[model samples]
Target: MKILKLEIKQKPFDDILSGKKYFERREIKPSNVIDYVSFIVDGKEYEKEEDVPEGDSEVMVKAKSYDRLKLVTGEYKGKRPYLMVEVKDAHVEFLYDENGDFIVGVEKGKEYAIAHIVFELGNVVEIFKGEK
Candidate 1:
């Protein structure tokens, strides 16, 4: 399995940890070869997505919830992945704001346009809190 590291803020992080948010929507899609990915939250390793296991109820839930989707974005880098996801199923389509522009990030009342990326997270695979 190929592991990718993502830097996320507190709100989205909390949403993911609480199971309130499942998909990590981004303007850029990962390489089609990636099979599994991981995120570090408070020093804990959370497995966002993994290969579809035949008889695993947990994995089944994820597989059933998400369909193979993709969208195009700005320039991006491609690397080898463990599993190959189709380009069409890996891209992220963005919704335009009222100004007919994509909002990348927001602070105060100002919005910014920038590239973004998403990742579908799974269960916690490892924990590294309070370790040296």
Candidate 2:
């Protein structure tokens, strides 16, 4: 499995840490083979890999999940994933963005099928406080 090193903003980072945000949305999807995504604060970097934590401190999830979301408009349809993911073990159905032009969210009461890949994350994993 490939590892993706991402730099995220402070607010999103805080949301992840606080459990307010479960998924990280992106315009471009990462490779399906990625099983671990290591995140660093927008301007921070880690020098040693060994310093990263393991086990319960991290949240394990599927790497990639695909779905087709029915748009609010009955005449149109949108692709799912909008890069949605569940944080830790929490269960979240779908994500919606009012500004999005495509599929914004799932249809009122319909069930949508989703696909998933294997991945893991945590509060602190080999975090190095420095510019990337």
Candidate 3:
């Protein structure tokens, strides 16, 4: 079968890395999984907590903290698929602020919201606005 690949942009710490450039593409499989080659399974210290939004029971993750994300085998549309990822453990830790709620990590009074998304291939897609 033909492989479908999805292209997503990634931004890393500029100072820590050599240079910022376009990230690689993950090979998509019939199962809807996209296997990424950039990430590695380095068992690191990760954290996990319940991310309960107001009046919500879907406990999505909040943050990955300082852990290396893992890439696990998952199913996509009933087929074994892969995904390009950042955090790939069975569960991830969410970064919290003093209030105990999931922090957006943006400066106060900002007009943006932080969102954490988990894709089918065990990737934590984090969208942050502004600086912490």
- Scored by lDDT, the top model is 1
Residue 118 lDDT (model 3) = 34
Better of 1 and 2 by TM-score: 1
Taking all chains together, the TM-score of candidate 1 against the true structure is 0.33
Model 3 ranges with Cα > 4 A deviation: 1-90, 105-132
In terms of lDDT, which candidate is stronger, 1 or 2? 1
lDDT for every model? 0.39, 0.34, 0.29
lDDT of predicted model 3:
0.29
Give the distance in Å from residue 100's predicted Cα in candidate 1 to where it truly belongs.
Answer: 9.6
Q: Which residue pairs come into collision in candidate 2? A: 52-126, 59-121, 62-117, 63-117, 63-118, 65-115
Could you tell me every candidate's TM-score relative to the true structure?
0.33, 0.28, 0.20
Q: Predictions ranked by lDDT, top down?
A: 1, 2, 3
- What C-alpha root-mean-square deviation, in Å, does candidate 1 show against the real structure? 17.2
lDDT for predicted candidate 2 compared with the true structure: 0.34
